[model samples]
Target: MKIARLSSADIHWCEDGDPQGVPVVFANSLGTDLRLWDKVIELMPKQGLRLIRFDKRGHGLSSCPPGPYSMEDLVEDTRELLKVAGVHSCIFVGLSIGGMIGQLLASRQPSLVQGLVLSNTGAKMGEAAMWQERISSIRAGGIDALADAILERWFSGKFRQSDECLAWRHMLTRTPVEGYIGCCEAIAGTDLTASTSKLDLSVIGIGGADDLASPPELVRNTAALVAGSRYVEIAAAGHLPCVEQPHQFAGHLMTFFKEDLHVTKV
Candidate 1:
């Protein structure tokens, strides 16, 4: 229920675990809110780890502004939230558009990002025309118009037929039109390859084998941008692997933090 009242936009957010523990900030995908990380959070070890999740402007309970938000706008919103919350240094885990935000933030403030995990995302996500067409469709018929198609891209066929898929479908369809379109515009306009390539911090790129939105190849290529970044693929998962395979998804993150970054208590 916490809210960060940034001048540009009010952001909805929540935090878990010890305040003094090693900080880990999570940024969700385009259409999902902080709840997107719930299952993964539940599976993660709590001791000596601080986990934080937030709803970007126009998504979840956050205020919906005008259309066409820039990647810089999203990055600034995160920066303000972390500053107001007194979060100093941390590892940032970002999914989809969330990964783009992480790249921009880390490039701008390296001291704040100790490590990074870019999951289910790429530096340059999709062509401008594709996003524009989606935005147009959303504006005309609202989020429900493309809900089924989006879900197909987000999850595998077997998952789409499962009973649990209903809840996720609701999550996607219920998102505000302005919010969804705004984020789409941001993705359409962003290309972070040049900046992300220069990152020197610990990095890991995670992908789902069946992720149609951002395929494994795209994630692998994005990871290659950073000289020493490692890449892992979670089998039998789609775009939102954290939802379909929470344990496996969380395991990848924990392994990276513990083995590579020397984070304690996982």
Candidate 2:
């Protein structure tokens, strides 16, 4: 684990496997840290892949920037974080807001991205009013009220009653409200219509079959906008399916990145 400083924020990251191996940079969804990828990493093929996971600005141990961030800010921070981490370029695998940032990163700086795994995210995110309401609620009170709503929507009803669901409540409680709102604003303001149409990289879009946030239809639509993009859905899981169904999620990812799409000569 390492904390790399960017001009605007601190990036908390973890690296595993050989330095010379295929670099895979993992980014988490809004309001969460790199730990979101823990189960996913455990299932990743170790033969040829080096895994990297990081927390975005204002989240986890990373520095908290002020309220609201732009996609460009997130993209710049990511580029600098990778540079400071001694990474030149990598195959990016992103979830939710991280996925949105990846789209911008690949579109704006093609050289820095090789292949892409965009999971549980949409090209253009939510409506402005919806995010504003969320931010307003957090500002009025805190994440407590919102956390329950998020959890209910993120995990299926069955999972909510299980032991696994209890463990994640802490993750929700410990989150920085400032960081959550910042990402909400970013999602509210940004539009990825251009990037989805423009990004010319090997891409795979994955979603949870039962996801409330980014549903299967949403994932399919997002992928269809991109030229010849592959799409897959993990069953019996919701928003954070990577955690709930790690084995199945990783299986889909491995097939997409390794077996399905041929990587360009690196």
Q: Which candidate is the best by lDDT?
A: 1
Mind giving the per-residue lDDT tens digits that candidate 2 earns over 1-266?
A: 68887788988888876567778898898877888989988887665777888888878888889977888889898999888877777889989898999989998889888888889988887799999998999989898878888887688888999987766877876789898888888899998987778878788889888899878887778777778788888888988889889999888877777664553222
Cα lDDT tens digits, model 1, 1-266, are 89889989999998898778898999999888899999999988777888999999888899998978999999999999999888999899999999999999999999999999999899999999999999989889988899899998899888999999999888888888888889999999999999999999988999999999999999999988998899999998999999999999999988999998998765
Q: In model 1, where do residues sit more than 4 Å from their true spots?
A: none
* Model 1 accuracy (lDDT, Cα): 0.92
RMSD to the true structure for each prediction, in A, is: 0.9, 1.8
| Per-candidate local distance difference test | 0.92, 0.84
Worst 10 residues of 1 by lDDT: 257-266
Q: Distance (Å) between predicted and true CA of 227, model 1?
A: 1.0
**Pairs that clash in candidate 2:** none
Candidate 2 positional error at 37, Å: 0.7
